[model samples]
Every structure is written in structure tokens, then in C-alpha cells.
Target: MVRCYKCGRKMKYIRGLKFNQYAVDGWKCGDCGEVYYDADQAQRILLLNKLKKQKFRLKLNQVRSNLILRIPKEVGEAMGLRNGSEIEFSLKDDDKIIIST
Candidate 1:
């Protein structure tokens, strides 16, 4: 709910525009052509964030049907004590969450 820099009016929400990594900070005014928070540090940080987000879908390939997990032995020992014990699992949010049975 920030105001536009040029017009001093509330900014309108217009998504889908991508940043140039060094050319964006805060947001732009649709009514006026002014960019919000026009500072070099802010713009560079926004660009770094944009780069991190862009890296999300940039992976080309992944392994199929194989999952791997590495766990500490002390946690397993405290939970129950077995090599082949049964376990239950469910997803919370987007990760494969585990529950001990």
C-alpha cells in the first residue's frame, strides 16, 4: 500500500514484469512513469533476488523415482531403535514430511 513517487498516489498492482537485476527497486508507477525507491543499493538487491527466483526453474533435469535421505543415528535411536522399522509419511506444504509410527 505504498504511494507512487511521482504522483504521491497509491500504487496500482500490476504484476508479471521482470527485472533486469540492476534496474529495479521497489516498484514502478503505472500512472506516472517513475520507479519507486530509485536507489542503486535497493536496485542491486532486487536484481539479486530476481536472479535467485529465476534460478528456481532453471534446472534442466532430475533423477527419476529415486529418493535419498541422510539422518543422524542418535535421533533414530531416541525414536525407537530399529533398522527396518515401519514409518509413515505425508506432505506439509511442499516437502515430504515424515512421521514415526
Candidate 2:
């Protein structure tokens, strides 16, 4: 639990698209509107930001009835992606594909 340092009010939990790349969990102060992150959440966001800066070249392949996009071992490990893990993909207006875990 987090407390508002300025006004002594309880903080509320919230998540959203922040920093133009990832959605993070944080606390918002009810009385003073201050925002803060817990220790684990802060660490996760930092690693995610670093992973977002990495680029990988992959060859698309067909397997059975699906198209497979393979991620590099280092890149996947850095992003905490494992076999059979689920991911989200989005196509931006500029035709760039965004992948997130």
C-alpha cells in the first residue's frame, strides 16, 4: 500500500499506456494527485523500457496452418518471453508493428 506523502491520503492503483511504449502499474494519491511506483513495478518497467529499444531481424516461416514469427533468443529472454507465451501485437498508423508481452 502507498500513502500520499503530501496529504496523508491513501493511494489508488491504476494502469495505462504510459511513455508511449508500455502500460505500467502505479499509485495515485487521492488527496494530492501525486504518483508513485512500488519497487517491483519500477524494476519491471525499467527492464521493459530497455527491451523496447532492442531491434531484431527475424525470418517469417510457415508451420502447419499458421505463420510463425521467431524471436531471437537474446531478445526474447530480455523481454521475458518464453515458449508458448502469449503476446499482443498492434499495427500503428505508420505501418509499424508493435509487439508487447
Candidate 3:
């Protein structure tokens, strides 16, 4: 059981709590509306915050008839992307392409 720091009340365990658009398990205080996350989930959110602040410039390489876009090492590590990892690609408007894992 977690206790709220501000109101000195028992916090309720909430599953799938949305934190910065990510689903995380945490405790919430009903009185003060305070939310708290465990260390592991907090670390994950911090990493995602760092990833959002970074920008990368990449080039496309052509092998045979396919073009390969290489992901930077730092970005790959932050996203936990591996060699065989599967990703989804989507086009926005007409000029921007979004890649999600």
C-alpha cells in the first residue's frame, strides 16, 4: 500500500495509467490527484523524454534495388531497437514519414 505524500492518505493502485502517452502502473491519490510511479517505470519515462529531445540526420543507402535507412546508434539504443526488430511505417500529409516500433 502506498501513502500520499501531500494529503497523508492511502493511494490507490492504478493499472495502465497513462503517463506522457505511455501506459504505466502507478499509484494515485484520490484526494489530491497525485500520481506516483515505481523506479523502473519512472526510468522508462525519463529515457523516452530524452529520446524526444534528440534529433538525427541520416542518409539512405541503396543495396540492389532496395533502399536502406540506417538508424543512429544512440537512437537505436534508446528505442531498444535490434537488427531484426520489426517497425511500422506511416506517411503523414505527404512529406513526412513516421516510423514506430
Candidate 4:
């Protein structure tokens, strides 16, 4: 059991606590309503927050009979994507697509 640093009250473990729409396990202080995450959870949340700050506008071009999408240099470098790198594409929803390497 974890104790709250502020109120010195026993903290309760909360599963699937929402942080920026991401679910993370956290400890909540009942007395002060303070939430805390473990090291792994905190790192994951930080990475997710960093990714949320990156936004790019790209243009779609038409080839002979196919559509071509160009990735910006910064985006590619950040993602560690290289020329001829294999990536997977999937439909996340009706309007969103997920690309993973």
C-alpha cells in the first residue's frame, strides 16, 4: 500500500485511470485526490504526451494510377523510418488510419 505524501493517507490503487485518454494504473489519495503512477506508467504517459505534440500537414499526390504520400524528413527521422522500410497500415476507424513500423 502506498501512502500519500501530502495528507499521509493510505492511497488506493485505481486501474485504468484516464490520463489524456490513455488508461494507466495509478494510486489515488482519497483524502487529497492526488494521483500517482509508477515509473513505467509515468514513462509511457510522457512518451504519449510527447507524441501528441507532434502534428504535421502532408499533401497527397497522384501517380500514374496510384496515390503517393510523402513523409516529411523530420517525421521520418523521428519515427526512425528509412528508405524501403516496411510498415503496416490498418484502418483505425471510418476516418482514421494507423501506420506502424
Indicate which candidate wins on lDDT: 3
Q: Write the per-residue lDDT of candidate 2 for residues 1-101, one digit (tens) a residue.
A: 77888888889988762533566677888778788765565676676677668766789999999989988876776567888899999998796898878
For candidate 1, the C-alpha RMSD (Å) to the true structure equals 14.7
The full ranking of all candidates by lDDT, starting with the best, is: 3, 4, 2, 1
Candidate 4 yields a Cα-based lDDT of 0.82
| lDDT, residue 71, candidate 2 | 88
TM-score of each: 0.31, 0.50, 0.62, 0.52
Give a tens-digit lDDT track for model 3, residues 48-69: 7997887878899999999999
Instruction: Give per-model CA RMSD.
Output: 14.7, 5.4, 3.3, 6.5
State each model's CA lDDT, in order. Answer: 0.55, 0.76, 0.88, 0.82
What lDDT score goes with residue 15 in model 4? 92
Which is better, 1 or 2, measured by lDDT? 2
What's model 1's TM-score? 0.31
Runs in model 3 lying further than 4 Å from the true structure: 1-13, 27-35
* After superposition, candidate 2 runs with Cα above 4 Å error: 17-21, 54-74, 86-101
Kindly give the stretch of ten consecutive residues in candidate 2 with the minimal lDDT sum: 16-25
Q: What is the lDDT of residue 82 in candidate 3?
A: 96
Candidate no. 4 TM-score: 0.52
Which scores higher on TM-score, 2 or 4? 4
- For model 3, what is the alpha-carbon lDDT of residue 45? 80
Q: Can you tell me which runs of candidate 4 are displaced by over 4 Å?
A: 52-88, 91-97
Q: Distance (Å) between predicted and true CA of 93, model 3?
A: 4.1
